[model samples]
Target: MQLLSPTATTYSELQNAYEHFNKVLFDNALPACLITLQREKRTCGYFSAQRWANVEGQFTDEIALNPAYFAVTPIVETMQTLVHEMVHLWQHHFGKPGRGRYHNDEWANKMESIGLMPSSTGQPGGKRTGDHMGDYAVEGGRFLMACQALLTAQFKLSWYDRFPAEEHVAHGQASYASQLSDPAAAISPAQANQALANVVKPTVKAARQSEDGTSLQAPNRSNRIKYTCPSCAQQVWGKPGLRLLCGGENCDSIPFV
Candidate 1:
């Protein structure tokens, strides 16, 4: 695939890619959903099963891509991240069981069936994590082949300008709040929470709160837990078992603690 100028990728571009892949790779089995560009601190991408009412007052599914993470990544790798999350969306809609942050056996089977093999180490044939695994697009896999075909067809994946100025810009350097001016950028967490409130009832909230008044948030991401790279000591805010790799280009091979 010809690598185009690394200009900022827009959310519309992401949606285009999602649609193309959904039709070609998934035979268009997946339903329509919201495609967004998120400035997530840790993960490369995310798929939410929780439905929410958008600004138009219509409920929709959500798939969020982290611009900060994908800005420095290769386009093919970025496509892989999108496909990976699509698998999650597929599982959620198809009744595949997953516990918390773990990518269970059923999920793995589905991933493999779609040409992605999960590895905790982000390498082909790396150590597996029980029945669950994470990271790395399998080399010579069906997903890779499909991406290659798309690239051959001259599909251009746009990049997102995660920063106001490109100077001294490395990956994951800008904060989401600072770059809300972009129309295609994902909604901020506060906006997401507000939107979710319209769909998720208060009874669900009561069940998640602790006796001490603290609320149990998402499984692998919480204010109480922090992820730090053992090599560079670059700390990212998230819970343990999040599969967070060091954001440093050179130290990315090292998993965060």
Candidate 2:
């Protein structure tokens, strides 16, 4: 894997990571709904964090892990976090609303599909991108603590509600606290618009190097992932067995890959 200099992770660089990882996860058969990774605050784990956007039916960015918590986060923990968040995204898009996103048989089945288990928190269970899910069980504590201060008093409620419609909207804004933390909301609607244009679609291209040093370009096929904008209901394509786009040029809704 290639190390991205702190200086190199500009918005464009972030977009590249978004494209690359979406393709990677999808190609691996665990396609996510949406993904973004940026240097944002109040998120835990790695240099980034991820969550499901219920209202938008996609996954949020991998918010960078605060430097203070990096030591304990193992590779498996990070992969679990990614898979966990992606499963939530899948539920939001493909599964019915009002369904529990975690701690249920569906979650277990999804985790199993990805070689993970909800009960495997910090315990030996399955394979991930690497072997290290225990890191979150350790490192995630501080982030949860910090998030308590940065997040709303009812952060749990901020995620979902029993009402299917409300649950959808609530999950869409997991980053609301982080967005508020921003001295400036540097991620503009225009920039988000640009990103929506570049999400993966079925096409053949030469294998190209990602910041992570892996090549993500893949062969085109009919079974590619498809998405319908939760906001607009416009159908679009993604990495395979996943959706990638919304209708409007400036889509604030979540996306998958």
Candidate 3:
């Protein structure tokens, strides 16, 4: 399907891209799932199990891409996010068990088999974690190659404009939380748009106080620990006493303080 324009925002384009990638990359092995665009902070895309229920009272998997994040990202990088979540979905359905947020070796191996080597730092090589490691995709990997091929074939891909600009909020500012009482009943497109219209945007505020009434402050940069990738000179900073990897798909350099 050819897109009407480079900046189109039609859902059909997204669906077509999903179907195309499923056929070309996964050999049509992945099951069908609901794909939606959401306005998420920080997260580029997410894959959740059984988040939506259909008219038949059966739960279905969901893959939500953050339009706010993707609007400014390169098309190739956007495809990377999609493929990354697909990898997660694949792992969740068929691969070995993974604990929490850690992507196990089996997951990494599967990702590599598809031409997306995981790097923690978005670089080239990454640290080894009991044989597998968390990683981002490498440049010129299979995933990118596939995306280029699809584009070359004139596949339609749509990306919308960025969300309206809001007041800048520092990282780790106010915390906004929500709970799902129950799966929402399936609704039509009109109903969905009405529901979205009624949603209130969250506001950012200063950090909250602790139990003892002490005001929270941002972490001290001096006291925090830092990790450096020997190969690419990439630096990651975080709380003290934690080991980190260079996170580069090709570099895979062990981090040092």
Candidate 4:
């Protein structure tokens, strides 16, 4: 380590330290994204903001995502959102946008190819609430996310070819329920239900369809409750019991038990 250190006062030394510190800070703040991009075969940069004018977009040489858009959102959703933005950046480099026009069918297809896009599911924005928007607008956003996890985690799909929803949920994605679960305790019925519901009903399915073939699946008219636990406000699946359970390891509450 000392050999690379020219004098501590050297511009090279100072620059290296600064760059190293920045990398550490950024990576720690967004570790999952950093790791995913490393595995992907694309060149780009990502940064989180308080909020974004658009959910995601491509600049001259980067893709920017705002975690604030879904600040209270699950980690998988955030990842999927960022991946969606990254795909657009890729389109800027790989496809023909005809000029400054960025969002188009080409970009949309790219999302589907990798399974980053949601399957058609529930309502518009999938399941809109005060904090986070819903998943896909159709009915199979969960299935899509599952498929996406299989593609990316198992088949090693590129970031451009995957959806963040499934990736976060699969293999126990902690991003979705980190605050809601007892990491080491028995998965609560309510927590489990929420996870299942989110898995089954993805947000991307809720988007409005376009005639231009940009939308992944045709929206369905299904009106399920989206299975959320009333206690923690987590999306759940399964025939829920009377009691609510927390997903956190330190705190598992059986409200009715």
Candidate 2: where are CA atoms >4 Å away? Answer: 1-21, 24-68, 97-102, 124-257
Against the correct fold, how does model 3 do in TM-score?
0.56
- What order do candidates take by TM-score, descending? 3, 1, 4, 2
lDDT of each: 0.52, 0.31, 0.50, 0.31
For model 3, the local distance difference test gives 0.50
TM-score, every prediction? 0.56, 0.31, 0.56, 0.31
- Tens digits of per-residue lDDT, candidate 2, 1-257, equal 99655545433433343344344443433342333432222223231124446676854533332221111122223233444455444544455422221134554455455443334223334323332222122222333333333223221100101111211111112112212333222121212243432332222222222222000112234433333443444555434333244437666645521
Q: How well does model 1 score by local distance difference test?
A: 0.52
- When 1 and 3 are scored with lDDT, the better candidate is 1
Better of 3 and 4 by TM-score: 3
Task: State in Å the error of residue 147, model 3.
Answer: 0.6
RMSD of each: 14.0, 18.7, 15.5, 15.1
Candidate 4 deviant stretches above 4 angstroms:
1-60, 69-71, 98-102, 118-257
Indicate the TM-score of model 1: 0.56
Clashing pairs in 1: 8-159, 8-160, 9-158, 9-159, 9-160
Off by over 4 Å in 1: 1-9, 54-58, 125-133, 162-257
Residue 254 Cα positional deviation in candidate 2, in Å, after optimal superposition: 46
